[model samples]
Target chain A: MNSSSYYRNNIAAVYIDANALQLEPVQRAISKLTHVRPQTVTSVAEIPAAQRNLRTLYVTSFRGAALSACPGTRVHRCCNYHTVDLYAGCPLGCSYCIMQSYLERSAVTVYADPSPAITAIRAQALAAPEVPLRVGSGETGDSLLLDPLFEITRRYISELADLPNVHFEAKTKTDFVDHLLDLEPKGNAVIGFSVNARQFAVEEGASATLAQRLDAARRAARGGYRVAFHFDPMFRSGSSDGSPAAAAYRDVARRIAAAVDAGRIAWISLGTLRYTPALKAQIKRPYIHDEFVGCADGKFRYIQRERVALYRSVVAALQQYLCPQPPIYLCMESDTVWQRVFGWLPQQINELEALFAGAPLRGESV
Target chain B: MQMERVATLVQRVGPLDIFDQTRLPPDQLIRQGLTAVLALAPLHDSAAGATDAAEAQLLWGGPIVRRAAEIGVGELPARRLGPLGHRDALMLALRMEARAGGYSWSEREAIHRYAGEHRVALDTELSQLVTAAQTFAESMERYLALAPIWRRAVEAGAVDVRTAELCGALPPAVLDTVSGAGRRLSFSNRRLVLTWLSELCGRDGLHEPAAVELAQNVMQSADPLDALRRLRYPRLSAMEDRFAALQRRLTQGTPLELKAPPEFEGAGYEVQLTLRSRDDLARAIEALQRMQEESDELFELL
Candidate 1:
């Protein structure tokens, strides 16, 4: 893990929901991490508007079901992945983040408690033992970027260990796994890192560098946790020689192969850069000028052919460089893309065969 | 914030010609039929141009004054309030005019500019009055910030507010050239050309006439949209053109409508063949056979 903490030095203040102050872990985390005196507030409306951005911290309890399906982009194939919202905002200011468009407030918020989420997962995994539950904690925020400060995700990793068919992956763009290194039984856990080419790293804000993240992957794999990589929002460099984006992704693939045991890699996912209308207005980079066509889900992405080419190049690099191939899937892609890339769609359970013992019928989380 | 000012005193009425008509906001509809004139400064030439409405502080009746000028009607049959503080006068005028049915971008710009200069804080009121998708300050900054020519481009309905704002990011010289080119296009096509030009400038780090020059040089047809789209999406456009050419060659001007998905974003081409008799069926089959013979090339485009 890097020594300088983005969360620790950047957090200007902390506000906890009044009801949540009774939670034991909340007090412990504040004492260990928060430098400023924490404020107790009844609701977010009570906080000053100026203090509602990422510099301020808000610890509130999530009232909805903590565990839910990915709400996969409509008109795209469902990956059957489930997500848990341990936190709702990140300090790492990735330039293209879609969260910028929709989050009503910019403050980094912690859900304060993970007990209900863990309980729900245990019951579901036990009830549907045959279904592979590839649950993640990175839906609304980076899994490990803030995990070290709150130490909430480790509970899921530690408790879900005995569930044979379940994998609790904590995805992060940062190389912060040191705190969880000492847990005796790390469980059925995979430390997933969002990996991208160095060209794309410039816009990812204060996330750990590619080299630092690779080192973290090596550490996690050696620590007996299966690791995964997500090459999402891949860019196209518009050259046959592949000097910029595609070649750089291939180089990243080579670095991953060099960094960890390929057999220990649980999965990899690919997605081209896409932005909603709200996010499109916030972006002012050269990348905003890319040749993108609006998808059926109302998000703009690289035209289908361009995306297929990108996926093919990355998948080929991963297959060629790794001794034992890992399961690779397209994130939020349509059926046409699936057919074009993999020659068939996974129509039923276990059709992906190696990806999972596969997911159950539609609407069921993987 | 609802803007409601107490009814000010209307001391007198004079000839419409004496009241200095041109000093009013451009359209009375914008002022919702101005209730009164807050007479303040006296610069004699308020006859035909924007007199910096804020500095002049003259809120003349909108349509009535224009109608008076048009039909030779005498005297404004309207209220005439005395000079108050500059900000107070603006608040009174805005209160009377804020109930307009709808606001065009240009009208909103004028109202926002006047309100902003006065520091009258009509932002909350303006949000309720207009359907701008951005905050009042945001819209004002983006719209007010555009170069004058680009601003005119917006006023003429050549482009939308959001697209015009993007055009604002163009380097001054490049925007000049693009604005000229965009002037020759229809509203929708004008938007397309400008958007493509902005993106091209960003992609190649080219600015000035050069960025627009590159897109303009792609003009192989009378249609700037066609040429600019080709510039923006080269590979996709080429694929589309090639597929269209192939269909023309194979179908040979018959009613064999073969269409690919929009932007090649989907799979499988659609073939709509119209047939009436066996002879028509025979010709359709012949075209289908020809298509089948070249299916590899056709499907490659898809």
Candidate 2:
């Protein structure tokens, strides 16, 4: 690991709101990182607003309901998943982040209180014992980015330890897993990584390289944890018969196959770059080179034909690498694209949920 | 100080001997003394009279004092009145006294005309004052001329306080050029565009040091408003540019109108070819064939 490549490299300062000042995990996280003394602020409003380039860290209490349905719009096919917002922003400033426009606050604010969320997850699991519940912590932030500092995932794992029907996933782009290896492994827990083409991974300023992430996956698998990968926001760059995008996906799959057994993999998800209309103005000019056409769903996406082609190529590559192909799904896509790429669409949301529930390591209860 | 000398000259030319005699009441005597002084002073050159009273006083006093000194009055002080402050106060007092005794606007005009006929050499201060006032008046005229459009826009809700403030900061000449284009945008959108551009120019409510430098660059541009729009709505402008490029490429040989998805919201594109006759239809078909041959370029629009 590069000494300077920690997930918090871009954070210039860290502030702790008065309500969260006594949280031991937050304090320990601050002490572990080589940042300046955490200044105590009465509220997030007291901290000076940061520029787009400055990563200001805020440890504050989240007052809203901790666990909520994924706020997917009606125009897209949603996985009917729930999200626990452990944090609200990312230190890694990917160019196409919806949070750039969606979030009014520019700082990366970590919610100090997770008890309410854990309780909500427990209640949800107890209420729906007959059905599998998919809950993740990365809807609004990189779940593992601050794991080494706060050990948040450990708390989550402990909370959901006995829930056979509930699975907790923490998606991230970083390879920060030193703190997670020692935790008693639970089949209900998943550590997922957001993977991309090498061009995007380098250009997007992700904290971890592809090799580092694959290594993290291998270590996590060896440590008895189910691992998942997300090929989200895939971009179109080359026009040759075997495009750079196609080759990059094949290479990623090959690396992952070499690192972990196919049976240990939980799931793989593919999503092309799509953004809200408001984000068009917020996206920097250099990152606007991809071919994005406005779709009927009120977001800019690769045209239907292009998206179908890209997914088919990537799915084929994934199949070639693994002996038994892992269950793959599309994220925030329409039924038409799903049908075109996968040859059939799930008749209902639960049917799709069932597919995720049946994945090899994902289905192992207790 | 020059003003005091000019006042002395005015006393010499007047018929009243009140300053020497002083038989009347103190207030009356002071009033008579001022009348004598103002009687000789020209108060109304056409250009000077058009200016505000304060500015007119400065312009008239400079020439009158220089002329009185040049004419060699032995009773005149060795030095001009203490400084600009004392001189200005004394002049203001005399003018007030003259007005109290029924000095009409017509009388002031007559004095101004007389002063113009006996014009003295222009002093440095008086010349600068006149130049500055004239420049200000000219700008005021231009602003007034554009006020109707500004008022209409404000009334129509096309311009908000922030946008108006930004426009106000711009040079009058640039505002005049851009006002036509600005009027074309909807009220809310115009505000949105202007506010966005203002921030890019670093004038986000509080003035930043960099904004002045950026404003200079804006002033030097051939079309400042267009430059501002490009910076403010870059994605929209780029989309328009690409559409135009596509239209030019496809309409090379046919009367076809190509429409991309509204706001590029969808991947599908449409082409409309109008035909008035069989020949026109054939020509349209030929154009479509040509477009099909170079379909890769069309796909780039995605």
Candidate 3:
């Protein structure tokens, strides 16, 4: 379903913070698009407890500096990256969403004020001129869900054009990127789509279908904006013959390879589904099954054997589709898993960061 | 002689009892007014005042007042009070207390008119008394209706008498005040839960004793609804608690980011590391190495 369906089916009302009301253009645009009366709330707490399941659009003033280091735990391997908190929640109710337990409030809250975020990015870019700083907006929420109404990505693209050192990633599970087509190609920004196997894409209740996401990635690639894919939360399906998870990953990779030149693909990240102990209770009952097992990292994860097998299958599939495979990284995995999957682990995290920041492959014009 | 005869007649008439001038019927003493007065008389001392009589008379009329007076003034046991009886007693008490000293003649007249319109025996102007009586009756009925289940529960040895009594006295509607989901529990579902609790208590061996303890614990819990949910979904509750405890242990004393699936359903967990400078990257690497060294204990959760 399209983003409009998310608004129609999920969002019961739209609440705008009073200070955010001052941004008349954004407020009026959202109101007109959603066809919902903009309720003026002084704070996020003003949204009634009863309407929590309904998505609440908060256009409140953000005082804290937006850009910060990704809050990684000590027990897992972390890719040294910074995250820009542009939004607080996502409407796409992926059964595996960490925010279900991480966030106190259920409603999607968008910070109307982007000035502070922009300032922080600029300062980081100026300070670390030599270091390639990858700052993404999808850390706490989906990056592009509200782009059609708020045009937040457009604002970011226009504002961050001067900062060449900072690479901005607008990550999403949606194909709503029509607003970005006409904007000047910044080369510094990447529109990353979080995709999954077909079964999961349909079952997770994400806004965009796999085909729709691939189409959006193709379009972004053709438009000279680099595209990235994240096969995150890879499901360990039980298939006796050939690995069903492998075939699914291969199928999606082939589709992506056919849709756009493989050279335009900047990076592909593989993260197996793992959950903190806190999220087990918050998970929907139907979604809870016997597939998950406790892992040493204090989260539920597939056994190492299963994880390694799934990663190997997907990695092999990806190689067959793309001529020169893009920089693929394992998310939140250990040194042993890295060594087992990719044959080696980087001595320094900066080496991996440098690889992502280096260059895109030269390909035939689409 | 005519003037003296007239004077003697006036004097004789004047000597007659003026209090008996109206010459009320004997039955009038047990009419609506006296009936109300006698009904409420037991609530106070035997030597009742005109105000008490007036209040009781106006609220319950003669027959109900007389019956209430016969019952005497003590807290009536819920078992002894029938629905209609409870309604009449509660309404009478509420109305009398609302206008304790007495009401004005005009107020009394308005009450009488209302009572006439409503075709009730008593002249009660207090609409709230009707609402209060209905509320009380419904509560009492609900409690009594659930009494058998409580009795069965106590007999099954699933719960103590105190817990059974409390549960019996409380209506299912009390769940509505506790939690949002509790409000949506259908009548049948509520009964099923009670049955399930009783069954749990009656289970054999260690499970039975645990169930009994759980029942007692639920009764003593600050949020009974939450306790009930835990009992209903034991496995889920235990898993959640274990998961939370694991998170606390893993995150202790380190800035390492551990990312897991929403419900730990997927294959891979992500460890995210953020670095501002090359030195930060080096520090992150050192931490990762330390984590790698502790992989045996850490990977057990997988």
Candidate 4:
């Protein structure tokens, strides 16, 4: 187990589907660490309603599409990345987390067995021998929070190490990559960290400090793995560009540039803080009070002009500080925003730079 | 199966002494004479096995009983249900109150308060008796928590349950400003107004009455919704205003139509020229040439 991994301490109970008990990976992983003994059930659905919350960890076999395409918002440019669903819910209670409105009443379910997901991802990578099939496991949950116990990333990193076109990235806000350091021939596996300015970083409940995450990123980079940074849901620091918050964002950019070699970066994504209609009612954070307006899409974002300005400032700092420019893309942004930031809309997926390019381009056009 | 009738005996009670308007109102006595009101006077089972001369609770037709008292009727016709226990009395009171059918906002507030105080279940035991969805304890608390203006607006059919729930989410200090702004707009506008104002109050950390003066001052605008929106989305609204000014300057009195993306949220800006003749086409070309000069400023809005 990784020294920094805060496993089962937060987990009050462990539940496994009765059928999933037959999987060797589930049985072995359970025997390896978990002090909270597993209780067998007919299914994860059998977990009592009262205990079905973030505190409980339900281990079960993922019965649905383990790997699928990112369902990018309509009218926004999608990164065309795919996600694996080995984990169903997140326990990190970031106030702005979208899952709060959806998974508030459910357990943090971990799909224990990785063979099925590994087989599925390998098939996709083999099927498209040329396309860079970027797949990550943090779409619905933090990638490394409880992963040290289950060693889910090790299975993917080891099995998919030979697939040059398959970039298997494990995205996390935690500083728990110590256990992953021993793996050999790590292939094109990348460890992505979600970074924020100092003030906002504190608000990401239970997430590592910015420095801690950067240190972890440096560690992963040193271990023959590329690293990516996501400056996502960037909270507006000030009305004016010179405000303390805005200044902190640039300093954050400077720090990232200093922390690792520019060549090790896979990609960096920027997104302004936005919310669904449901979050507005339940969220009580101080930053949510900023000036926002409903976009053409149903989500509310910081007014359009403000978002463009923030993106320009952050991208400028990242471009200048890093010796070699990394592929920085705006996540789920309108084409107008893309035009404003990069001066051109990426009509082809390859235009996103090395992060997305080299995928076998079939007759299909993105 | 035949049902057994509930037995009640007719009794004459002192008119002004029956003061429980816990159920029906006193308006029933206006044009109609007193059709006996149901009264409850708990009889002590140990000694005083008879009804006391003290005021009895009017479980039904309180309006008739009170109106009879107002008309100088010395005595009122009433029906007495036998001895009632403490729990049975609470159940009967809440049940009869719900039986009044369509309740006003205050009436729902009142019943819910009584039901909550006595641990009486309104949703389950009285589900059939409840005509309004707002009668449930959880839903009633939402409406009851609203500011008086919003509650009145809700009562007058101006605000909706969802909008009221939105207002309920605001800090207690900001609800006044948000709901006050919402009160003036049309139904849909009321929703937008309240939603924006609440968000503004939350995002800016404007908690105290003094801090929320911008919203309060905006109330004096000729159009409250427009003013509140301008305050809520200062940057977007300012950019929109600036773009309009720029468009006017560039068009220079030509029928040249230029538009930025909706909410300035998209990447494309559009230019249109409605032409009817060759001279119109010439003028349109002239305007297009003019628009080309400041395309940077215009496209910046998009």
Question: Which consecutive 10 residues in model 4 chain B have the weakest lDDT in total?
Answer: B1-10
Decide which is better by DockQ, 1 or 3.
Answer: 1
Interface RMSD of each: 1.6, 7.7, 10.4, 2.4
Question: What residue pairs are clashing in model 1?
Answer: A80-A366, A134-A366, A161-A187
**How do the residues A1-366 of candidate 4 rate in per-residue lDDT, one tens digit apiece?**
233345646777788888788876677667765467778998767899799999888888767887888766766767768888877788778889988989978988888777788899999889988777889998989888877777878888999999998889899988889889989889989899999988776568888889999999898888888999999879886333325365677888999988999899988889988888888766767676676767756889876767888898998999899867777888888777777777776554343755545322222354
Query: Whole-model Cα lDDT per candidate?
Result: 0.72, 0.63, 0.59, 0.72
For residues A1-366, write the lDDT of model 3, one tens digit per residue.
466666666666777778877774466456556556778887778888776642666667665668887765445555656787777887677777888876646677777778888888888789978877787889888898876777777777778877777778899988987779889856588889888877665446756888889899898888888888899978776322223476788788888889878888777889887888667545533224334456546777765656778898888888788876777777877666776777766443343657434322112121
CAPRI quality level assigned to candidate 4 from its DockQ score: acceptable
- Residues A327-354, model 1: lDDT tens digits: 8888888878877877776553233563
Judged by DockQ cut-offs, is candidate 2 incorrect, acceptable, medium or high?
Answer: incorrect
Candidate 2: tens digits of C-alpha lDDT, residues A1-366: 443346446667788888887887787777776755678899778787453233677888767887997776546666657899897887676777888776645677788778889999899889979777889999998898877778778889877978887878988888887688888847578889888777666545656888888889888888888889999878765322324476777778788899988888878888988888677656643334344556655778865666788898988888899876677888877666776777676543343557444332211231
Computed on C-alphas against the true complex, the DockQ of each candidate is 0.45, 0.07, 0.05, 0.38
Worst 10 residues of 3 chain A by lDDT: A357-366
DockQ sort, best first: 1, 4, 2, 3
Name the 10 consecutive residues with the lowest summed lDDT in model 4 chain A.
A355-364
True contacts kept of each: 0.59, 0.10, 0.07, 0.62
What are the runs in model 1 whose C-alpha is more than 4 Å off? A1-4, A238-244, A348-366, B1-101, B104-126, B130-138, B144-157, B172-184, B212-221, B253-255
Question: How would you encode candidate 2's per-residue C-alpha lDDT over B1-302 as one tens digit per residue?
Answer: 22244445543432111121222224333323222232222232243333112222321223333344445532322222211232233233334333322333233233323324435222333222333232323322333344554544543455643356445544333334333453355555555545444556432233544454454555456765677666654555676687778678878667787787654444457988788899888888888887788777665544
Candidate 4 structure quality by residue, lDDT tens digits, B128-224: 4444443466567667777776677687776676677765556544545555554465668767766777666655556666446755676667787
